[model samples]
Target: MNITDLMWKNATAYGYTFTRTPPDAACAARVTLLEWLDAGRINPAVARVFPLEQAAEAQRHLIEDRPFGRVLLTLAR
Candidate 1:
């Protein structure tokens, strides 16, 4: 899908909050990554998501479990 469509879909599906920060190195990198995602050039692997309050547990899981993919932390809405 195109960048506009991908961004709209993700914003609606994931409750994304778009920001209008000034351009910098990080912003450029983020834009590039979003473009790559929009183009389906890369697939992110997620191991598991832990609630924000369970950060210690998540860290333990990372150290002990050694998961093959990323361990994410999500905020409660």
Candidate 2:
């Protein structure tokens, strides 16, 4: 079966090529990620968040590339 025949409802799940963001492009692309994810337009590789108090632990995991994706820092109030 041809993917294009699905009429794009499976667009986010298949039939596209994604590139690794270069350092120069990463900063500009960050906001776009949130926009797309929130709109359910793309299925990200991973999504994780940590509260402000656990920021240090989150940084450690990120530096080790353990949780290798966007880590949202959440606030508690």
Candidate 3:
């Protein structure tokens, strides 16, 4: 098995065109995202939330090819 062997494995890239979209449309999408999070539609994929300094730890894990999903790094509160 090789990297190129998985070409298009993730399918098409998707994203929001906030900069190009009208302000109202962009705002609506943002609101929708917030609502989804509030309603538990969006949840953390990782077991732990890493503090900012843990960024280096996260990088090492990623570089070492450790299992991961959404790695959330938090700011000081």
Candidate 4:
């Protein structure tokens, strides 16, 4: 909220350089992410999976239950 919190405390104090990059960088980052996924390097922790039909239930679970990790909604039958 404050300048100290935004710049010094959150960024500089932690030794992290917060910066903004060009929009094209996002596309390149996505490509890199896909490459990592293909190489089986990115293993996301899945909490639970819900079918598309159970979208409401999934949302409710997310809002109320708040399970750890990702709650995936799949369209596959």
Q: Which stretches of candidate 2 lie over 4 Å from their true place?
A: 1-35
Backbone clashes (count) for model 2: 0
> What is residue 10's positional error in candidate 1, in angstroms?
37
After superposing candidate 1, which stretches have Cα over 4 Å from the reference? 1-26, 38-40
User: For residue 25, what is the lDDT in candidate 4?
Assistant: 81
How many Å off is the CA of 76 in candidate 2? Answer: 1.4
lDDT of 1: 0.82
Q: Taking the tens digit of each residue's C-alpha lDDT, what string does model 4 give over 1-77?
A: 25677665465433322246566886687788789989999886788999999999999999999887899999985
**Each model's Cα RMSD:** 13.2, 8.6, 4.6, 6.7
**Between candidates 2 and 3, the lDDT winner:** 3
Q: Model 3 over residues 1-77: C-alpha lDDT tens digits?
A: 24564565854544567899899998999899899989999874674567898999877766675655666689999
Candidate with more favorable, higher lDDT: 2 or 4: 4
Q: Pick the candidate with the highest TM-score.
A: 4
Clashing pairs in 4: none
Q: Taking the tens digit of each residue's C-alpha lDDT, what string does model 1 give over 1-77? A: 25698787775434333365555855787898899989999778889999999999999999999987899999999
lDDT of each: 0.82, 0.72, 0.74, 0.79
